[model samples]
Target: MNSESLVKPCSYDPSFKVDIRSHEPLWCCAMTSSDVLVEMSALLSQLESICRKENEPSSQVSQQTGGKRKRHYSNTFQNHGMVLIERMTNLLQKTMSPVPTLLEYLESNSCAILFPRAVLYVKNPTAKHTPIKRAPMDGYFSQATALNQLISLCHQLQHDVTTMTNHKYIAHQIALLYQSINQLGNPKVLLDHRTSIETTFKKIKAELEKEGEKAPCLNSELIFWLQNLTSSLVQSVKTLSAELTSQMRPAMKYILQSTT
Candidate 1:
């Protein structure tokens, strides 16, 4: 999904009065939980294919040519692996679910692990590539791990919003969070959140437009609304994460066993 499509343009009109309560809900095409599962399965299959290809030995040939082919495949693997990582991240956040253990397993201790470094090198090919050494894995990535990370991030943002006096920064943060909700392709999940986001942001934009040159500051009402919105987001994501974990458990277990 194009990130640009997530947020619609907010047109400001001088005559238009901002009424937060009277705003209609934003509607979009609905997607089911089963559909999300199908998408996840497809991604897992593609990732698995890439992993298998990365591990395949180069065919016998002249030493120089063999090295070239190996490098070519390594580069290909890195590029594809990076794309999958991004897609997976977007999918997880969109579904309000955590990364599956099986997905992480397929990525660990493989060419997938090198994707981050590869990305850095791509940005600056002249920079020396330094290998990062880590201790042996104590545990695999799991749903709980991802959930904790999400909670931590939310808490950080919440703290920033509460303490920050800069209205523009706070507004930008709110817009970013609201835009993230639009990433939820599922109509069932998006409806309420989208409605809340749309009304709140429109009101804010209208207020800012009205203020013109004056410094923008959120009123108590807006602050309260933001708090409620964030609370709802956390609760919804938690519920969805649990549902996804339960639904995908069997499939994940099967994949892990087969890989072993």
Candidate 2:
């Protein structure tokens, strides 16, 4: 029998189906913020680790030396490869599937990691079906919200730069920063810094593009890219903080200006 025929087909248990109808929308108009970006980041790392472990060869010696395996041993590796492919495919699908609530998304087992603490903004789906009472914004104004988001974006960027394993994830992080800056009206000071940031990001992006979607190796150039990227992000955050301080306290701005 051919190697393909000798391998047994893998089976998987069906994922649990979430019943949206049974779950009422919890405060459709309410918006709750949490520091879940970093948590989600950690979850992504865990997923990558699992994928690597699953796809790894069963025997290092067999892989390195090209030694002949007994028929039964060969079969075991074949079975494992087949099962790993199926599991990884299912995981990809699950992670891509959209859910309304953070809780439901986690329960879906898309990530297949235990997320004990996730900071998330639970978006309500019921608002699409009907109008609901809007949440109060007494302490949460537009500028304040945008500033907070930018700060969070900087943190995410820094995290991605420091722990960059997959190029695709890093690309997503860069895109988030670009989108947020644009949404914030592309303030002049931020726009100036963005040029420097984008320059560093593009160099890293080019290197990653050449390497394709695999774990990156740390080289001197790559380290330099990461350091420059981190520095740019820190500068961006500082710029925003200063602007926010000026807006919140005009006297501070005047005092700093007079001192300068």
The best candidate in terms of TM-score: 1
Clashing pairs in 2: 36-119
lDDT of 1 by residue, 1-260 (tens): 64657768889877788654222225534545444445544564455445544444446545766454341246666666666555555554444345444344334423233233433332433444444332111122344444455445456567765787656666566666655554444445436866877777877766555546465667778877777777766776677553434434544554455345
CA lDDT, every model vs. true structure? 0.52, 0.46
What TM-score number comes out for model 1?
Answer: 0.40
Tens-digit per-residue lDDT, 1-260, candidate 2:
64657767777646755544322324433222122323343343333333333333444345445673322123453444344333333333323335234445445433322211111111221111121122222112455666667668777766766676654566666667666666666566677656765667666567667645467544467666655655665666666465544333432332344335
lDDT of 2 at 42: 37
Estimate candidate 2's alpha-carbon lDDT, on a 0 to 1 scale. 0.46
**Which 10-residue span in candidate 2 carries the lowest summed lDDT?**
117-126
